[model samples]
Target: MPEHLRALIVIVILATAVFSLAGKTATQLIPARDFKRRRNLWFALTLLAFLTHSFWLYAAAATFCLLLTRRQEHTPLALFFLLLFVMPPATVQIPGFGLINYLIKLDHPRLLALVILLPAFFTLRRQPGVIRFGRLWPDRLLLAYLLLVALLYLRETTLTDSLRQSLYLLIDVLLPYYVASRGLRQLQDFRDALLAFTLAAMVLALIGLFEYARHWLLYRALLGALDIEWGLMGYLGRGGSLRAVATAGQAIVLGYILAVAIGFYLFLQGVTTSRLQRWLGGLLLAAGLFVPLSRGPWIGAAIMLATFIASGRHALKRLFLLTMAGLLSLPLLMIIPGGQKLLDLLPFIGSVEKENITYRERLIDNSLIVIERNPWLGSVDYRKTPEMQSMIQGQGIVDVVNTYLGVALEVGLVGLMLFTAFFVTILQGIRQALRRLPRHQNEARNLGRALLATLCGVLVIIFTVSSISIIPVVYWSVAGIAVAYVQWVRLQTQPHATLDR
Candidate 1:
C-alpha cells in the first residue's frame, strides 16, 4: 500500500475512534429507563477507550460508570464537580501530533457534556414546583450582562470570532446558571453537589501535598506521554520549593480551588452536628490551603474565615481558638531550626520576589493603556491587536492578570458594570436569604454564609488574576445554587407566590 494511503487510513481510524467515544458518552446522558440494557456495551466501550489511552474517552466513560448509574438527579452536578477535579489544564497536546493539541480545559468538556444533557434539564424545568427564575435582581442583572456580551460580539474582529466568543459566554456563563437553577431544586441536591466538591478537594489536596514534598508534579509525566506540555510546570517559590499545582494547571488556579474548598469545608464544620466529622474535615482543608504556597489564596482563606466567623454562629468560637493557636505558635516556629524555612514558604513572609511583582505591575500598566485606547466596545479581541502583540513581544506578558481590567479590555466599562452587577445581585440574594430564613433553617442559612464567603474570597483572588477559564464556571454554578436556595426559601415563606413558568 502507498504510504500516503496508509496515513489517510490511520487518520480516518483515529477520527472514528474519537467520534465513537464522544457519541457513547453523550448516550449516557440520555434520561432513559433502559440504561441497564446497554450496561454491558457501555462497560466494554469504556474498557476499550482505556486500553487505547484516549484520555477524554476514558474520562467520560469512567465518570458515567461512577456517577451516571446512580440517581439521574445527581449525575449532572456530580459530573460537573468531577470535571473540575480530573480535567487536565488548558492546551494539552494530542498524543501523536505535538502541533495538534487537545484543549482539555474544564469549560470545553463541561460545555459539551451539558449541551448533550440540555434536554434533560429542559424536562426538569417543566416539572411542577421546580424553582425556576424569580424576580431576583441578580437574575435580571445577569440577563442584561449576557445581552451586552451578545451585542459586543457583533463588533468582534471577525464574524467567526464573534460567534465563538458568544457561544463560550452562553455555555460557560449562562448555561451553568440555568442548570444549577433548574436541575438542583431540593436542598439535599445542593448538599450532594457540595459533598462531591469536598471529596474532589480532598483528593486534589493530597496530590498537591505530594507534589510539594517531592518537588515534582506527578501528572507531568502522564501529560508528557500525551504530548501535553505545561509551560508553568517548573514554578518555584521562596527557598526554591516547588509550588503545587495539584490537578489545576497553574498555582493560582489551584490556590483558588483550595480557597473555595476551604469555604465549603468551613460550612460543613459549622453546620454538622457530628463533632468528629466537623474537626476532621476542617483540619484537612486548612492544611490543604497551605500546600499551594500562593499568597493570594492564603489571603482569600483568611478573609473567608473572618466572614464565616462574623456570621455569628456558635462555630465562631472554635475557629477563633484555632486561629489563636496558629498565631501563638508562630514565635515557637521561628525558634526551630527549619522554622524559618517553613515561614519563608508562606507568601509575603520574608523578602518578596521582585520579578513577579515587577511583571504584574507592568502587565497592569499595559492593560490600562489598552483600555484607554479602546474604551468603548473594547478592541473586539485585544490579543489580536498590534499593540497587545507588541506588548507581548516586549514584556513577555501574554494576558492581563487582573480580572476587572481583563473584562474592561474585552467589553469596556459597560461590560465591567454589567459583570459587577451580576455578582452584586447574587450577593444580595444571599444576604436576603440569610435574613429571611427562620432560626430552625440552620442548614440553609449556613449554606448561604458559606457561599457568600466563598464568593468574597474568589473576588479577592480574581482582582489580582484573570477569571477567564473554567474557574468562572465554578463561581457561576455556586451563584446559581445560591439563587436557587433563595428562591426556594421565598416560595416557602410567601404563600401567594407561584413558581415561574
Candidate 2:
C-alpha cells in the first residue's frame, strides 16, 4: 500500500474511534434503566477509544456525557463546571502562518455548554409568564456590556475577527451566565456544582504535584505530537525548578482556580455534616494552590482564607489549631527529602520573587501608556495600532498581562465600567440575601459569605494576569448562581409579595 493511503486510513480510523467514544459516553449519561440494552456496546467502544490514546477523543467523550445529561436537574450546572475545569491546555496553529495565526481553542468547550443550554432556552420560550425579568440588574448590566462589545465591533479594522470575538463573548460569558441563572433553580443545585468542581480540583492538584516533582507535563508531549502546543505549560524558577500549570493553560490561572476551590471547601468544612470529607478536600485544594508558585493567586487565596477564618464559628480555636499545626510540622517538613523544594513552591517562600515583580511593573507601565491614547473607545486590536506596534518594536513589550488593562485596551473605559458594574450588582445581590436570611440559617449564610470571598479573590487575581480564558466564564457562571440563589431567597422570604418586573 502507498504510504499516503496508509496515512489516510489511519486518520479515518482515529476519527471513527473518536465519534464512537462520544456516542458511548452520551449513552452512559442516560440513566442505567433507560439505556440498559446498549450498555455492553458502549462499554466496548469506550475501552477501544481509551486504547487509542487520543486526547481529543477523551475530551469529546466527556463533553458528550455532559450534553446527554443536560435534561437532568443537576446535570446542566455540572456540565458548565466541568467544561471550565477540564480544558486541555493546548494550542493549534495553521500551517505556514505567523505567530498570530493560532486557531481558536478552548472555545469549543464553551460551544458545548451553549449547546447543552439550548433546551433550557426552548423551555423558557414555551412558558412566557415563567420567564420573569424583574430585579435582574446584573443581567441587564451584562446585556449592556455585550451591546458595548457589538458597538466596538463596528470600529474594528478586521470585521471577521471582531465578529468571532463577539461570538466568544456571547457563548463563553453571556450564555454561561444565562444557563446558571436559569438552570440552577435551588441552593442544592449550586452545592452539587461546587462538589463537582472540588472533585475535579482534587484530581488536577494530584497531577500538578506529579508535574512539579518530575518536571514533566502530563499531556503536553501528546499534544505536541499532534502539533498542538501547550501554552506556558512549564516555567523554570528557583534555579530550574518546575512551576506547575496543571490543566489550566498557565500557572496563574491554575492558582486562581485552586484558590477559589479552597475558599469553597473552607465554607464546606464549616457547614458540611461529614467532617472527614471536608478536611480532606480542603487539604488537597490548599496543596493545589501552593504547587502553582504564582504570587497573585497566593495573595488571593490568603484573602479568601482570612475571610473564611473571620466568619466561621469558633474562629479563634480554629486559628490557634492551624497555627499550632504549622509550627509542629515545620521541623518534620525540613527533615524530609525534597521538603525544602516543596516549601519553595509556595509563593514568597524562597528567592524567586524579584523577577516577576520587575516584569509586572514593566507591563503595567506599557499598558498605561497604551490606555492613555485610546481612553474612551479602546483600540479594538491594540497590536494593529501603529503606536503600539512601534512600542513593541522599540521595547520588546508584546502583550498586556493585566486583565483590567486588557479589557480597557480592547473595549474602552465604558466597557470597563459596564464590566465592573456587572460584578458589583452580583455582590450587592448576595449581600441582600445574606441580610434577609435568618441568623439560624447557617448554611445559606455560609454559602453567601463564601461566594463573596471567592469573588473578592477573583477580582484581585485578575489584576495580575489577562484572564481571557475559560476561567472568566467560570467566574461569571458563579456570579449568576449567586444571583439565582439570592433571587430564590427573596421568593422564599416574601411568599405573597409580587416581585417587580
Candidate 3:
C-alpha cells in the first residue's frame, strides 16, 4: 500500500476509536436535546479530508461548518472547538489576486473561524445587547494590546506585510474570542462548547498515547502527502523516549492541550453520574498527559488543581488531602519499574535536561538586558543583540521559551502590561461571578472555578514556552468563556432571567 493510504488507515482506525469511546459520554454530558443526535457522519467527512491529504480540505471543512450553522445543527463555537485540533497546522499559502501580490495563509482552524465564527460575530453585534463588547475591561485591554502590537509590527515591516499580520490577528485571535464570548449564551451552550473541546482534546490525547507507544509521529506522513513544511511537524524526544506530538506539531504543545483538557474534564466529570465512566475518563486524560513528557504542563497541571481546590469550599482540608495523596504516592511511585527515572524527569527536581532550565534562566537574564536597551518600546532588532546571540542553541536559533518575556521583548513593557492586564481582568471577573452565584447553583460555580483554574494554568504554562501553535488560541478561547460566564452569572441575578435554557 502507498504511504498516504497507510496513514489514512491509521487515522481512520484511531478516529473511530476516539468517537466510539467519547461519543456516548459526550451526548450524556450535553444537556441540549438537539445536540444528542448522531455526530458520526460529520466526523467521518472531516476525517476523510483531514487525513487523505486533499487540497480541497479547507473548502470542504468550511462548507460543512457553514451548512451545520445554516441548519442550526451545531453552534459556531461548538464546531470551532470540535475541529480545532483535528487537522495539523500545516498551512497552505494561497496566491493573492488583483492588487494583492502577497500570499494568504490559512489552516483548518482559521478557515473554520472565518467561515462560521466571523459571521456569527457580526450577527452578535446586531443583536439587542445585554452586554456590549467594550463594556468589559478585558475587552478593552485585549483590543488595546492588539492595536499596540499592530503598530509595532507596522513599524518593522512593509504596509502589505503589516496588513497580512493584522488579518491573521483578526481571524486567529479576535474571531475565536468573539464567537466564544457571545455565542455561548445559555448553560447548554457552555456544556456543548466545553464538551466539544474536551472530546477533541480526548482524540488528540489518544493519538498522543499511540504515538508514544509506537515511536512514530502519526501526522508527519499527512504533512508529507500534503507537501506542507510545518516546522514543528518533526519528531521530538526526551530521556530516550518518544514524546508524542500528535496533531499539535510539538510535544510541549500537545502536553499543553492535554493539561487544559484535564482542567475541562474536572468540570465535565461533575455532570456525569456513572462512577466508572468518570474514572475511565480521568485515567485516559492522565495517561494522555503523561505521554508528552512536557514538564511545564506537569507543573501547570499541579497549579491548575491547586487553584481549583483553593477556589472551592473547604479549601484547606481538600488541599491537605491532596498533599497527603501526593506524599503517599511518591513512595509507591518509587517502587514501580522505571519510576525513579520518571520522577527524575520532573521539573525543578529533574536531572534530565537540567540544562534546559539553565537555558531558560540565561534567556530571561539576557532578554532583560535587551529590554533595558529600549525599555519603553522594544527594539525591532532585538534578535540581533549580542546578549541573545550568546544563548543560541545548536539549532542556531535564540529560542524565546518564555511567552511573557517574548512579549516584553517585542512590544516593550506597555504591551506586556496590556497583555497581562487582559487575563488579570478576566480572572477578577470570574472570581466576582463565582461569589455572586448561590450555593445551590453548584454546577455553574464549578464551571467558573474550572475556567479560572484553566486560565491560571495557561498563564503559567506559557511562561515556560512561547505563544506558539494552538497555545494562544486555547488561552484566548478560555478567556472568552470566562467573560461569558461572568455575563451569565449577571443574567441569573437579574429579575425574570432564566439560566437553565
Candidate 4:
C-alpha cells in the first residue's frame, strides 16, 4: 500500500468509529448520513490510492464485495464481479523488501485460483472428471484428456522435468477449464455471472478514466506525494503519458473486455436501445481500446466490430460514420504520431530495441523445432531447452510465448490432441447455439457468439504471452457466469438434451 493510502484508511476507520460512538451503540450506531459521508471520504481517498495500487485496490474491492454480498444480491454482486474481472495482472516483485513480498505476493495466485479450483474440487468430491460434462459436453473427450495426462506421466524416454510439468498441467491448468465448463453448463448461472461482471467492468473503467482526467484534490494533494498516477501507461511497454490501460495489465486485456462489453451492450438491449446510446457506447469502446495501444487487441476489436456489422447487420449509417472517422483520422495519425496506437506501440515501434518482431519470429522458429523433434508423441521439456546442448548455448527455457506451445510443452502431443478436442467441442456447442437462434432472436445468441469470438482472439494472442498470469482468475470466474447464464436460458426453453435444452 502507498503511504497516503495507509493514512487514509486509518483516518476513515477513525472517523467511522468516532461518529458511531458519538451516536449510540459504539461503532455500530453511526447515523446513516454519517456513514455515507465517511464512506465518500474514504471513496475519494481510495480512488487516489488506486493509482499506485490499481490491482490491489481493484482486487480488494472485489473481495470486499464477495465478503459483504450474499448470492441473493445478484445485481450488485454481478457488477462487482465485473470489476474484479477487470483487475490488472499483478507482477508484485519487491526487491530488497522481504515483508512487502508476502503482503503482495505474486508468487502464488492463491485467492483467485482458489475461487475456481476449490469449488470444482468440492463439487467433484475428488473425482478427476468434469463434474457437469455428462450433461453438457461429451464425456469421451474429457476421459481422453485424463488418459493423455496419464500418458505424459508414464513415458519412458521422457525428461524428468517434463513428467513433473505434465502433473502440474493436469491439475493447475486443466482444473480451471473443468470448473468453468461445469458452471457455464447452466444458463441462469451464466446470466447472473455476466450481469455482475459487466456492471463491475463499466464501473472500474469509468472510475479509472475519471481519476486520470481530473487529478483532483485527492490526487494532486495525496497520490502526487506518493508519485503515483492513475493510468495504464505502466502496462504498456512504455510508461509516463503513453496511454490509458484503465486497470488492465496489457492493451489486449482492455480491448478484449471492451469488445465483449460492446457485444453485450448491443445484444442485451438490442434494437430497443436508443440511437444516441448506440453511438455513445460505440465511441466509448473505441476510445477505450485505442488508449491501451496493443496491436493484437486492436486487431481483435476490429475483427469483432467488422463481424458484428457484417454478420449481425448493424445500422449502415453508423458503419459509414465510423469509416469516415477512420479515414479523417489517417492524416492526423501520420502527422501527429499519436494517431496510430498500433503503429506507435512504445517498445515495439518507437524504441531502439525493435526486437518485438524478431522475438515473435524466433518464437515461431522454436515451435517448429520442437514439432520436428518428436513429431507424434511430443518432446519432453522442449520449452526448457536451455539444458539441452542442441537448442541454445546458454539461454533459459525456450521463451516460446505461444500458449498452445506452452500447453504442448507440459502435456505433450496427447495432451495437445485432447485440448484440440475440447476446443472443437466448444466450437460445436457455439455453432449449435447460433444455428438454433431464431431470426427474431438474433440478440439471444449474439452475445454468446461474441464471447466465443473474443476467446478465439485471446487464444491466438496467448501464443505471445502467458494467458493465466493471475489476471485470468477473476476474468474466467465471470466468464463462466456468462456461459452459465446463456446456457441456462436456452436449456429452460427447449428439449433438455443439452443441460435439458
Candidate 5:
C-alpha cells in the first residue's frame, strides 16, 4: 500500500520477467548450473516482491510459458509442481505477527486464462485434431460432473460462484484434456506433458519461495514499525514462515505440492542409480515439504510416509529414512519456543475434531438442516449464502474448510452426491492402475504407487480444507495425466491394441 513498497513491487515484477526470459531461454542454450542460477535469481526477486502480491501473476504466467515451451521432459516435474501448488496455498501472507491467519484466495482468472487457455487456442488454430471421444475414463465422468454442478448452480443464489465453477471445469479440466488428448496421444507426449508441468512448478515455487522471503522481511519491517503494538492483519495477509505461498493460494497447498514432489522423487528413487544419491534426493524433497507447515499437508505428508512404509519391498529404506528424520526433527521441534505455543490451539483443534465441530460441522449441519426442511431435491440459490455472507461481513470471510462440504454448501445435496461420485471414480482409476501394473515393470509400478500416494494425500487435504477453486486445476490435471499414463501403460503392455490399428 505504501508508495515505496508499491515501487519496490513493480520493480520486482520487471526484474522477475527479465530473469524469467533470460533463465528460460538461457537454460535451453547454456550449462544446467547457469540456468539454475538464473532461475534462482528470478525466484529471489519474486520472493522479495510478494509483499504486494503483484509479481505472483507474472510468476504464474512465466511458469506456464516455460513449461509450454519445454515440452520434452517434464511430467515428473509437472506432478511435483502440482503438489507444490496444492498445499501451502498460493495466497499472500506475512509472518510471526497479527491474527495468525489463513485465507483461501486464488490468483486472477484473466491471467489463468492467458496462461492455460492460450496454448489450447494455439493448438486448436494450427490443425483440426479431433479427440476420439469414447466416453473416456475421465471425460465421461467430467461431463456428468459439469451437468450436476450446472443443475446446482441453476438453482443457486450466487450466480457468480456458479459461473466460476463452470469456468473452472471447462477451462482447467476440459481444456487440458482436450488439448492433451490430441497433443498427448502418444506415450512420449504424455511423459513430456507431465515433465513440462513439473518444471513449471519448480520455476514458480522457486520464485514463490523467493518472494515469500522478501515479504517476510517486509512483514518483519512492518512489525518493527508497529513496535510494541503487534498486529495480526499484516502477518495474516502474508502467510507464515514455513513457505511463502504465492499464486498457489495457501502454504498448505504449497506443502502438499512439495509432498507430491517427494512422492515423485520416491518413485524416481526406486529406479535411479546409487542409494546415497537416492537418500539425498529424498532429503531434499522432505526439506521442501517442511517449508509450508500447513496442517493439511502435514496430514498429507503422514499419508505419503505411511504409503512409503507400506510399499512392501521399498518399505525398509523409506521407513528407515523417515524414522531417522523424525528422531532428529523431534529435538528441534521441541526446543523451538513457537512449537509449544501452538498448544493453545489444542482446544480449538479438538473442538473441530469433535463429531460435531465448528467450520466442518457447521457446514454439514447447515446443509443437512436445509435438506431436512426441503428433502425433495432441496432448495437451491445462485446467490451467495445469506448466512455465510453475514459471517463474512462480521469477520471478513472464510469458506467451508472441507472441500467436499464446501461444494455441498454451495450446490446442496445433489451437487455433493455427483462430486462424490466423480472423486470416487478417480480413486477407482488409481486402484485399477495399481492392480493392472505389470509385476516386473519397476518404473510403471513405482510411478503408479507415487500417483496413488499423491491422490491419497490430496484426498486427505480436501477433507479438511475448502480447496474448491483449486480442485479442478489440481485434481483434473492429475486425472488427465493418469489417463495418459494408463493409455501409455496399456499400449506398452499390449502394443497393437489401438483403435487406429
Candidate 6:
C-alpha cells in the first residue's frame, strides 16, 4: 500500500476504536434526535474527504456539509466544530488572476467558514427574532479588534492583498465567533454544540495517544493523500519522546485542544448519565494532554482547574486540598522510577527545553522594544527589525510564540488593547451572568464556571504559544459561547422571557 493509504488506515482504526469505546457516552450529552443525523453527516463528509483525490472535492464536501446543516437547529455550528477539531489545517491556494495574483488559502476551517458560515450568518441575521451579533459588548469589542487589524494591514500590503487578508480574518476569526454567539441560544444548543466539539476532541485525544505510543505521526501522510503542501506537519521531540501532533498540525495545538476539551468535560461530566463513563472520558482526555508534553497547556490546565474550583461551592476547602495534593505529589513523583525525567518536562521546574523559556523571555523583551518604536499603530515591518531578526530560530523563521506579543508587534498598543479587551469583556460577561444565577440553577451556573475557567486558561496559555492552527478557532468559539451563555442567563432571569427563536 502507498504511505498515505497506510496512514489513513491507521487514523481510521484509531478513530474507530475511540468512537467505539467512548462515542456513545459523549453523544449521550446531546439530544438523541440530533445525534444520528449529525453522526451520519460527519461520517459522510469524512468519507468524501477520504475517497476524494483533490482539495476542491474536499472543499465541495465541506460546502455540502454546511448547506445540509443550514436549516437544522445548531447543526451548522456542530458541523463547524466537528470539521474544525477533526481535520488538520491542510491548505491549497486558489490561484487568482490579473492584479490579485494570490487568493485566499482555503484550509479546513476557512473553507467551511467562507463557503457557508458567512452567507448563513447573514441569512440568520435577516430573520425576525434571532439574536443580533453586535448587541453585546463582547461582540462590539471583537468587531473593533478585527476592523483595527484589517485597517492596519493597509500599511504594508497592497489594497488587494490587504483585502484578501481582511477576508481571511472574517472567515477564520469572525465567522466562527458570529455563528457560535448567534447559532446557539438555548441550553440544549449549548449542550449539542459543546458535545460535538468534545467528541471530536476525544477522537483527537485517542489519535494523540496512539501517535505517542508508536512514535509516529499517523496523519502526516494525510496531506499527501489530499495532495497538499502544507508546512505545519513535521516531527518534534522532547526528552527522547516523540510529541504527538495528531491532526492538530502541531503538538502544542493538540495539547491546547485537549486542555480545552478537558475543561468542557468538567461541565459535561455533571450532565452525563454514567459516573464511571464520564470519569473514563476525563481520563482519556487527560492522557491525551500528557502525550503532547506541552508544558504551556499543562500550566493552563492547572489554572483552569483552580478557577473552576474557586467558582463553585466549597471553594476554599477544595482549592486547599487540591493545592496540598499537588504539593504532596512532588515528593511521591521524586521517589517513583523515571520520575526525575517526568519532572524535567514541567514548566519553570523543568530542565528540558530551558532554551525555549529563555527565548520566550527574550521575545517579550524584544517585542516591547520594537513596540515602543511605533506605540500607536505599530510598524508594519516590525519583523524586519534588528530586535526581532535576532530572535530568528535555526528553522530560518522568527517564531512569534507569544500571541499577545505578536498582536502588539503587528498592530501596536491600540490593537493589543482592543484584542485584550475583547477577552476581558467576554470574561466579565461570563462572571456577571454566573452571579445572576440562583443557587438552585446549578447546571447553568456550572456551565458558566467552566466557560470562565476555560477562557481564562486559554488566555494565559496563548501568552506562551502563538495563535496558530486551532488555537484561535477554539478560543474564538469559546468566547462566542460565553456571550451566548450570558444572553441565555439574562433571558432566564427576566420576567416572562422565553429562550425560543
Worst 10 residues of 3 by lDDT: 32-41
Structure candidate 6, residue pairs in collision: none
- Compared with the true structure, what per-residue lDDT tens digits does model 4 show for residues 1-501? 755455455434533442333223211222344334323433443453444444446445544543443232322223233324323434443233543322223322343444435444455544432344445453456567766766766664445434544644544444554455554443334444443344334443443344334422122234244334433234233333343444454445555565555555444334333555446545655565555445555655555555455445554876787789876865677677554543355334454335655766666666667666666657655645532333342333444555566666666666778766655666556656666667666545666666555555444445555454433443344344344434644664575534331
Cα lDDT, model 3, residue 323: 97
lDDT, ranked from best to worst: 6, 3, 1, 2, 5, 4
How should the candidates be ordered by TM-score, best one leading?
Answer: 6, 3, 1, 2, 5, 4
lDDT of each: 0.64, 0.63, 0.82, 0.47, 0.51, 0.83
TM-score to native of every candidate shown: 0.78, 0.78, 0.95, 0.63, 0.65, 0.96
Q: Point out the higher-scoring one by lDDT: 4 or 6.
A: 6
Query: What lDDT is obtained when candidate 5 is compared to the true structure?
Result: 0.51
Better-scoring candidate (TM-score), 2 or 6: 6
70 Cα displacement, candidate 2 (Å): 3.9
Better of 3 and 6 by TM-score: 6
lDDT (Cα, 0-100) at 62 in candidate 6? 66
Better of 1 and 2 by TM-score: 1
Off by over 4 Å in 5: 1-131, 156-168, 180-234, 237-243, 270-281, 308-358, 374-394, 468-471, 499-501
Greater-TM-score candidate between 3 and 4: 3
Best by TM-score: 6
* TM-score, prediction 5: 0.65
Q: Candidate 6 lDDT, tens digit per residue, 1-501?
A: 877667667777876776667667756766555666666666666666666877798788767776766676454677677667556787778898887666877787787777557776887688666766676788788899899989988888889888889988888888888888887777888877787788788888888898888988877876777888877869999989999998899999999998898788778888988878888888989999999999999999999999999999999999999999998998888999988888999889889989999999999999999999899788878889999999999999999999999888888888999999999988998988888899898889889999999999999889999998878988998988888888888888885765344
How far residue 78's Cα lies from its native spot in candidate 1, in Å, is 3.0
TM-score, model 6 to reference: 0.96
Number of colliding residue pairs in each model:
0, 0, 0, 19, 53, 0
lDDT string, candidate 2, 212-249, tens digits: 77776553544443345544555544536677775576
Taking all chains together, the TM-score of candidate 3 against the true structure is: 0.95
lDDT by residue for model 3 (1-501), tens: 656567567767876787777666776866344343325534654556555566466467556645665556446687677777766876778778888875778787777777778878877777665357776788899999999999888789889989899999998889888778877878878888888888778778888888889987877877777677877877778898999988898888998999998888878888977788788878888888999999999889888999999999999999999999988877787899988888788888768999999999999999999999989778788999999999889888999999999999999999999999999989999999998999999899889989989999989999999988888888889989888888888888785764331
